[model samples]
Target: MTEPTGLGMSKVARILMVEDDEDDYILTSDSLEQLDSYQFDIHWVTNPKVAVEKLSQEEFDICLLDFQLGAQSGLDVLRQAIKLGCMTPIIMLTGQDDDNLDKLAQDAGAVDYINKEDISTGRFARAIRYALARNEVASERLERLKAETQNRSKDRFLAHLSHELRTPLTSILGYTELLLQGEKAKESRSELNIILSNGKHLLSLLNDVLDLSKIAADKLELNPSEINLDSFIADVFYLLQINAQDKGLSLVITAPQALPERIRADSTRLRQILINLSYNAIKFTDHGQVAIKLWTEWVEQKELLFFEVADTGIGIPAERLASIFKPFEQVEDIVTRKEGGAGLGLAICTELARRMGGELSVESELGKGSRFRFAIEPGDISDVPRSELHFVKADTNQDNEHYDPLQGRVLVVDDAPDIRQLVQKICDGFGLQVVTAENGLQAVQMCNESLSLDTPFTLVLMDIHMPVLGGRQAIAQIREAGFTAPVIALTAAALKGVKRSLVDIGFSDVLHKPINKKALYQCMSMHLAAQESGEQIDEVEPHILLVEDDVDAAEVSKMLLESLGAKVTLAFTGAECLAVLQSSLPVCKILLDLHLPDTDGLSLAAQIRTISPELEIVVVSGAQIEASQLSALNISRSLLKPLNLSTLQSLID
Candidate 1:
């Protein structure tokens, strides 16, 4: 053949021959001899023991093992060689015809199984070439998996460090601000302000790094909902207008007439992107306006939401524009010198845009202005025409911080002493009496103890993570204990989508840690005002236990009961039903099916009453039920299957 073939590689190919018969070794050598592109060095060993010793050294690239060996088979040598850290590729050879031997040979770590009768020049050469190619691919895959695992470990370490850093920063910033509020030591006020400002900047940077870590680890999730564009855009402008106005810069909002009025997106993430970009524009501009405009682009048949933040501030130079969006990379110019930043805003915004099925790009002219554009495929869009809107500056705050103090009692739960005292001081300013608990278990006990005295907390501020008991479980127990006051979660966990999780776990509202007094005050005021006006959460649904052997029938009955506003638990056997009762859960009634798999339904009723005498038991079945039998067991009622909605409704009532 021409230059070379696969078996005739450029380098010398080392082959190990493990054969008891000398004739087979010669035939194997002759077949490989057909390819002459490179030299082939074959090491022959007639003893299986000697073959294993040579193979263990890994000095050969490939091994050819014959199935027929004296006393011991070649498969044993192959397996032993593999067990001793051998990486050499192996091909099993047999002299006789046997169908099952091929599978057995391959199963014992041989790369291929070949018959000596089929040892043609081309076939034998191709078999050796395929084995080597496969080994190379497998080695490459192992390295890739190792790299990915290391990356994940690094991400986790970064996240833990960020969280640990925030805990101490919270107390430092909280106390500094509190001291400044009282006009304590007029001469030291400026120095205290400096500490507060720098602490906040550091906190902001920590948040940025943590967010990127979460995104990189694929831990960040998005929850999109329909939003009214008019209010959403107006709110963004209103929030930033004050910051812009303070610096003599204008915040402008504009939209093209063709833009849709409503779209589906995660409002929190969208707001974060808009705020970061617009705030940067404000911070950079000395005395010009930051304009945010919205439009749409048609890609194929789908419409994409296109928005731009154009600022008439100091523009980026041509050479630095390429690296401006890179994380931790800032365009080092006069403007950047005056307004220092972590340089993570644009990088984070770009990543979040991609997660929403879009991209972010920018254009700028030196000493003129910069324009940042973002386009996203909004999950859903409406055809309604958008109303024209313009930005107006938000009103400034008054100097004095005074309020009509609320008259009520509040319980604050936290593991940290500093946080507990800080919250107590804030609540004192509101004129609300305060109670504190170091952990969730203690908080539940305090609430129960207070209830016995005819005095209970008007509101609860609970921390999410704690020792002994967690906030979620504590709140559940609080609810079980008949405490219906509004419970607000105080958390330091700032991961995206955490607020939704807290709310679903029965929290009325979520307040992030390194707490802002303004936000906390507003949340407390809103919740307390609602409580004062007799507006409370709806009554708890009555719990019912339904025991049925048929899974389909049990599910149907559970659904029907839930439709009538009752919480139903279904058990397919008497044992499961008994376990449920033993938990001491508040059950209003028990629905029993007369047909049984383990024991009679009526017999199970006797055990149910022993756990709770007040829990009424109702028997359900076809014409197999009789009223006289149910009355004998002190069972409440007897009803037929394919339940009547009215009868089920009466049971819960």
Candidate 2:
């Protein structure tokens, strides 16, 4: 033990002694006072209740307890101290060798035990110091455990919330698509727009939650790249301007005249930190301005950049400012109601700054305003000259050009009349030759008649499920009868095997139901170009084919394709096409449906592919395909139900 010097006494450990017996209290205090080593100040309390009260009112280095304290026992005092989170070490003193009382006192919260008779000044002083050290270790352990448990709970909650949000959002986007396609009333469009906006906001919230969780778990990796700091800051400012304006707040940014032209940093993380701080400033400030100031400094002879965000608004109380960086801690209880947040913004910012080899600090005065600042080592930018700096404004109204493909002969086949008409109209818009059939039998007859007249059908769009000779069976039969053509599968079956299985059987490719014009054109352009390159075209039209079971759906899809300059032929079933092919009709391309009344679409697609591997077969269905099945069937692309035209065109082309 080290003896107390003038300096040591200034930092001397203080101990509190609790005992009902005045003599016992004096003896303990004197024993500790006589110690020639470490310095300590002992406060005595003859009443156990008073000792517990004193422990709460002030801080102490350790506690000494006498087990027998008149009517009140030392255990009662220990319990009270423990309940109040008095983490100071405690040594239990007993008059007699009562192991039971010692055990009780230790269990109640005492850090160690010593018999009163064994109380030498030297031994007592040593015991007090040892116990105090041990108590500090135990308290730290408990705090760490508590923090870990809390982090795990928060992560689980975020994951569950994300899952719940995605479910409803999917439906909202789906319905909105339907409405935008003119399937819903015009009056409901406004409501749909509102839903879309809210859905976007919800998605943004989910993204923030995920980002925060990743940061907390130390899994948020930054991709540092060379960036112009001035330009980067300007972009962040521009994006956050709308948010500030919405809150009726003014946002101002100030940068040095000769700022660094380039810096190597994680642009995304830096942007996130700035955005969070600025957003909070704007959120808290009901009026006045939120100003962002940038500057540089020399710390330890290292060039460092500092950013400060200050706002004129209601500031945080001094006492509460320390806790503002704690997760789920907000300055006001009504913060969730007045301004919505999970109280994670500042916490995340703090961690982010620490990760960047710096720390975040704040200064504020209640009823005035607050300023937050962080510093980071400036990255090398000596290679970039000031003259090269240029400001590029973002365009607000730029739109992507719609890609359109040349239309060729297309086929529409389904049991529904409305669908066929819809498809015909869309194809007609693009100057495509549109043909339709109710079932496989009718389709085979038309192909046979064309072959007899020396004018073979260009393409066959076969429906999967029809009254007779369904799409798959018709495709297989057409292949068996010696017709080599590309077959595209179009059906509403969203089962795992629906897409790949169709390709395996004989279809060239798969498309989903409720087709969009853009997707249709893209698909047609890709496969059509392949077939027209003098590649071995399947007996059906080599360019494009559509296979759908639903009549209205098939027609709509056909119309969309035709609107893109495609010619189409419709077929209802596999057997009907088989009959025609058996009669020696030569068609270029075939669009086969997956869910046929006669046979499985995948099996038919496989069989067809086996006969004509060079033929382009695309399966169009309303089902989601599994990666395993896709690998097994060797099919690359698949479209979901209510397919988007742009996506379709991309896949096929």
Among these predictions, the greatest TM-score belongs to: 1
Where model 1 places Cα greater than 4 Å from the true spot, the runs are 1-115, 118-155, 176-193, 214-323, 326-329, 333-343, 351-361, 366-410, 428-432, 440-460, 467-489, 497-510, 516-653
The best candidate by lDDT is 1
- How many backbone overlaps does candidate 2 show? 90
For model 1, which pairs clash? none
Candidate 1 residues 6-44, lDDT tens each? 563554667888887888888888887775544568889
TM per candidate comes to 0.55, 0.38
Per-residue lDDT tens digits for candidate 2, residues 1-653, read 12246654423667787877787777776777666455677777788778888888777777788887888778888899899977677788988887787788778878778888877645666786677566557766667768867976986676566545554554555446545546445777667766765665665566566667777566666567887776787787877787889888889888664668777777767887888888788878888999998876777876777899999978888878889998787655533357777777788788878877678999998878899999775576455554322445443212133455355666677666655665566556556687888877776666555555444545555657667778876776666555555567656443333554565456666765544455556666666677778564333333354656555567776776666666554444555434333322333445566676676557766766665555455566668767676556555555666755775556445
Per-candidate alpha-carbon RMSD to the true structure: 12.4, 22.7
* Backbone-clash count (model 1): 0
